[model samples]
Target: MAKKVALLQGNEACAHGALYAGCSFFGGYPITPSTEVAEVLSGELPKIGGKFIQMEDEIGAMASVIGASLTGAKALTATSGPGVSLKQELIGYACIAETPCVIINVMRGGPSTGMPTGPGQSDVMQAMWGTHGDHAAIALVPASCQEIFSETVRAFNLAEKYRMPVQVLYDEIVGHMREPVEFPEPGELEVIDRTAPSVGPEAYKPYDTSFGDVPPLAAFGSGYKYHVTGLNKAEDGFPTTKADLVDAEERRQISKVKNPTALADIESNEEYLTEDAEVIIWAYGSTARSSRYAVNELRKEGIKAGLFRPITLWPFPEKRTAELAKQAKAIVVPEMNLGQMILEVERVAMGACKIAGVHRVDGEPINPGQIIAQVKEVL
Candidate 1:
């Protein structure tokens, strides 16, 4: 098969990822860095008989996508920092209701509309714990345009397979940068459609634990009718005040999604000058790109340094990192946020190896030369 190379931006690749993932609907409000995703989807969805709507605001955009998912469509929405904060309530609703959908947050610096065009990974903690109640959520971070394309497909698969809302966490650098990416031809991949109940309406239970941890979803227009609401309820989708039932409902919501072996896992790209070296550089997202360049420069100077890139930001790759920590002399973590993911690196390292953080949150990326200097100091 001949490969076709198209120079594409990260946001456009994300739109293509949704189409390939069987996303038939998109609802979003335009915001910088992330606006391109909504713009591209608005144009592409219609050609494939999919639907696109620009809602009045971010909350409406989030609410609408969840509603569409009830009709058995794989749905999506995109936003930046401020918009992501606006949608947290409905995001919680999607979590409790086990709605299958994808939310792409192309992050920018901010507490409230910080910088529209600049890059920042400030939303890392929010992506995992932003919603009101205690619930398990998965967020996938992509560093490059290729990863944006591939991880978007995985985002949909995780959402539908487990019947939950999943996030694709992209920074501004990846959202706007242009790169070459290859698209899979039709029928080269597997898509998981939401499982529907085989039984009649009377026998159907909304949270049917007997079948599997996941209950089969019944579409709204389907004759097998069911009710869905935000209130804490039992398996049949009805509101209940019973204490134990509410406890059971909440526990299942988290446990079913939080199992690291079952749901959360990490992806990484590493180089092994560490086999004989003392220092290691741990980074991800756009920072990983810089670190990659820095590591090669270190090698040129006869410095033994290795790079460890985490593709799965959440669940934080504890097992692999613990093993890497034992062998290295020192670990350096560089991120756009001030000491966010660095805490995880320290926890897993357990003082067995010296760990230091190189972080900046002023909306500028860390320089590769600065990273190379940090590596040389440790060596």
Candidate 2:
């Protein structure tokens, strides 16, 4: 097969990436900035013998995706910030149920429909904590259309590997921007399928801990009759009120991803000119693009500045940031929201370096000029 190159929008590329990753079902509501994702999948899924459903609301859409995922389909749902807010309960349900699904959140300014058509990174914290409880999350932040495509596939892989919901976080800028992308061939990319049960139907335990931290998931209607609920569950998948069982279940859920070995596999970060730099710009999503340019501009003027962009936002990539803080004099965080990620940077840097935030919440992206100025001030 010839390499396929096309000028694609970020949302469109995300849909394509889902298809390539063997996603067979999409249940989503149409919301600004993210509607293009549903629009593309609606047309594409049927042709590929998959299913596309526009649920009446965001809550229903989230529930439907989890239902489909239970049946062993690589399922997905796309929405903006407000829609994600509405989906929190079901997202939490998916988390506790250990369902594997991909959620694409094209962030718009928000406290409640704050800016439907504008960009904002206000959901950075929400993605990790919006859903109530002690559950782990995997969120991939992509800065470009091409990165969205690749990361969307990676999100599904991670979700299935960990048996939990994974989020692909992009903003209005990257979600709507058009860029040229050459998609890799099927053989060139790695596609992961969920682990299946090894034992007979009668011997199956959906949440079996004896097997491992992440037990094999049995598909619905796969001759396995099992129960799933939002309440803490035992190894057999039944809701448990026992203290020991509840504690064990919660600990397993959190530790599966929190473990250093598992976290290392899911985390991704990009460093630019940071080896000998005295200043570092910590950014992600579209803001990193501006931060990159600012790094180059400062380096040209003999300012030893670099960039540390976290592609994996949820695990937070604290290990890498801590390492950078030990050597750098200062770390400047530029974000679309009012210093959301800066808090995480501060916690990790731990007074090793001065931390400053160049924040914009008026629905405009943080530009290169703003980052350069902040870098100069911090120095």
Candidate 3:
């Protein structure tokens, strides 16, 4: 059979990728710029024997996804910034309870109901720390419609593998932009499912510590009957106030995702013209698209500029950034927000290289000209 190629919006690609990644349940409320994700899934999931529910609000949508994931379904939900705020408690619940799920945040201008149709990257920090408490987060930012599709699949795979919620963050520009996306033929793309309990029901412990950092998850009705709660819990999954047990559980949750090996597995970035360039531009999402163009143009003019685009937002890809910092004389970060990710770059670069920020927040995207000017200024 010929490969399927379609001109799809970012939201449509996300839904398609979720389905291809074995997502069987979707629960989301309709929000501008992200509603298409729910709409697409609502129509497509039923045809494939999966389920889709339009919830009353973002909080309900988030809770529904957690419930679905508990039943061993690969569940997903889509929302924008305000919706993400409403979903925070449940997101934290999923973290503490160790439920595996995916959340897509098609970012719009923010704080309150800022701008529904405009783009913003202000949620970069929120994606890392919006949910209360200490827990590791995994967020993937896609630059193009095609990447949003592929990264959605990667998000589900990481969520299941790490037993946590993984977020896909794209801005309004990418979300509404339409482009041709070629999906892999069946069996061409690798799909990962959660590991089932190896022991008999009588011996199963949902949060078993004996196995390793990530214990296998048992389905809710699979006869395991393990307890799950937001309160700090023990290895058996029951809530506890015991300081020692609480401390241990928290550490395990952090370690599970932060383990060097696991972190390396999930980190992704793109490097263009960095090999011999003196100035490197750091960007993500739609901003990277402009930065890439600027870098190419600068290179042609005999200015040694490069581009570093991070796909994995959380876990920040600091190691790779630091490595590049060692080689480059200056680093320029252009983001749609008023400098959310630049702080991260500055921290990682640590005086190793001169760093500059190009920020835009008038509900407009940072263009290649703006990025090129910043690159020149820094040089």
TM-score-sorted candidate list, best first: 2, 3, 1
Write the residue-wise lDDT of candidate 1 on 56-135 in tens digits. Answer: 99999999999999998899999998998999999999998899999999999988988888999889889988989888
Off by over 4 Å in 1: 263-277
Please, what are the lDDT tens digits per residue for candidate 2 over residues 1-379? 6788999999999999999899999999999999999999999999999999999999999999999999999999999989999999999999999999999999999799898989999999999998888889899999999899899999999999999999999999999999998898886778989899999999999998778899999999878899999888888888889999998888889999999899989999999999998999999999999999999999999999999999999988988899999999999999999879999999988999999999998988899999999989988
Top-down lDDT ranking: 2, 3, 1
- Which of the two, 2 or 3, has more lDDT? 2
State the TM-score for model 3. Answer: 0.98
Q: What TM-scores do the predictions have?
A: 0.94, 0.99, 0.98
Task: Give Cα-based local distance difference scores for all models.
Answer: 0.85, 0.93, 0.92
Worst 10 residues of 3 by lDDT: 184-193
**Backbone clashes in model 3:** 0
Clashes of 2: 0
* Model 3 per-residue lDDT tens digits across residues 37-146: 99999999999899999989999999999999999999999999999999999999999988999999999987999989899999999999999899999999999988
Q: Clashes per prediction? A: 0, 0, 0
TM-score of 1: 0.94
